[model samples]
Target chain A: DVKVTQSSRYLVKRTGEKVFLECVQDMDHENMFWYRQDPGLGLRLIYFSYDVKMKEKGDIPEGYSVSREKKERFSLILESASTNQTSMYLCASSRPLAGAASSSNEKLFFGSGTQLSVL
Target chain B: AQKVTQAQTEISVVEKEDVTLDCVYGTRDTTYYLFWYKQPPSGELVFLIRRNSFDEQNEISGRYSWNFQKSTSSFNFTITASQVVDSAVYFCALRNTGGFKTIFGAGTRLFVKA
Candidate 1:
């Protein structure tokens, strides 16, 4: 079974602090994603990386950035944490699909998630 | 813009009762994927099922089932003989063909009381 490991299960940080959330996947998946889950907003994509040193901005990437220096590790960085940045952060990885004809079985494997609280 | 809507915010039912969660999506792409994920108290989103655009067949696995209706743009999930362990927040998601980003709905929280 594929395993996605998150560095922290619960994190607390004060405003203006720099926060780093690390995630590693054992499966050699080509795609990695970061999402923040809120009460009513569901899961909003923060950033995604398809390859080493390559990242793409998701729907909500204003105060967040990502770094993927190696194939197994992906990191999400909060430049300066604020109260609004407090949320449950989830990391997921998946294998790349070819195209429309690709099988639907290619699903995402998620980590246990890091619940970050900004004070 | 692709969007997924899970209209049912929350549902509570006694054990052994059946419950259905509704999902509706909007997308212009001819080929897309729909998915249902379960987020238990552990906070990890577990992939439940995934269906592509061309397949409209309803599927049943154990006590869980999914109904896919392309004409209505809906993919609903049902759990028969619910148990306390089945309580969780269910999310419906949509991803266009070859797209990297997946859009998720607000989610429906199901509570099964013993």
Candidate 2:
């Protein structure tokens, strides 16, 4: 079974505080993503890493930063937490199918998610 | 740019009734992937189905079926005889041609009444 684990399930932080959300996947997938999910906005990507030390900005990357030092772990960082930045954070991993194989990159394994509240 | 849309924000249905969640996508690439994911109250995402662009054929698993139309760029999911346990937030996602990242819709919340 594939397992994606988040460092925290629920977190509360004060405004202007720096926060870190950690994610780890045991599936050894090459691609890792960070997304924030809001009530009506659904899931919007913040950042993604194709390989170790390689990162790309997604739709909602402002006020957020990501670190992928290792292939199995990806970390999402909030430089200065604010009320507007509070949302459910999700992490997912998948293998790129292009040039690889058809069956390898079909689905993504997602983490349980971490709900963050900023006051 | 690629985008996904789920027009219905919320839907309610009686138990054992049938309901369909609509999803439309915008992508210029001819080859792509569409997916449906269920997020229950527990907040864990469960992958329900995935269909590639080449395979537009409909699929049925138990009471769940999906209709994929390339011309209209729609992938709709229908749940028949919906039970209380079937209530959740359903999201439609599109995987781009390169298969690097996936874009998700706003999601439709389903409520099943007993």
lDDT of 1: 0.93
TM-score of each: 0.96, 0.95
Candidates 1 onward: DockQ, in order: 0.60, 0.55
Off by over 4 Å in 2: A98-105
lDDT of 2 at B63: 96
User: Each candidate: fraction of true contacts kept?
Assistant: 0.61, 0.46
Residue pairs of candidate 2 with colliding backbone atoms = none
**Model 1 misses residue B107 by how many Å?**
0.8
lDDT (tens digit, per residue) of candidate 2 on A1-119:
88999999999999999999999999888888998899888899999898999999998899999999999999999999999998999998887665764333368778999999999
lDDT of 1 by residue, A1-119 (tens): 77999999999999999999999999998889999999899999999998899999999999999999999999999999999999999999998766634323468889999999999
**TM-score of chain A for the candidates in order shown:** 0.93, 0.93
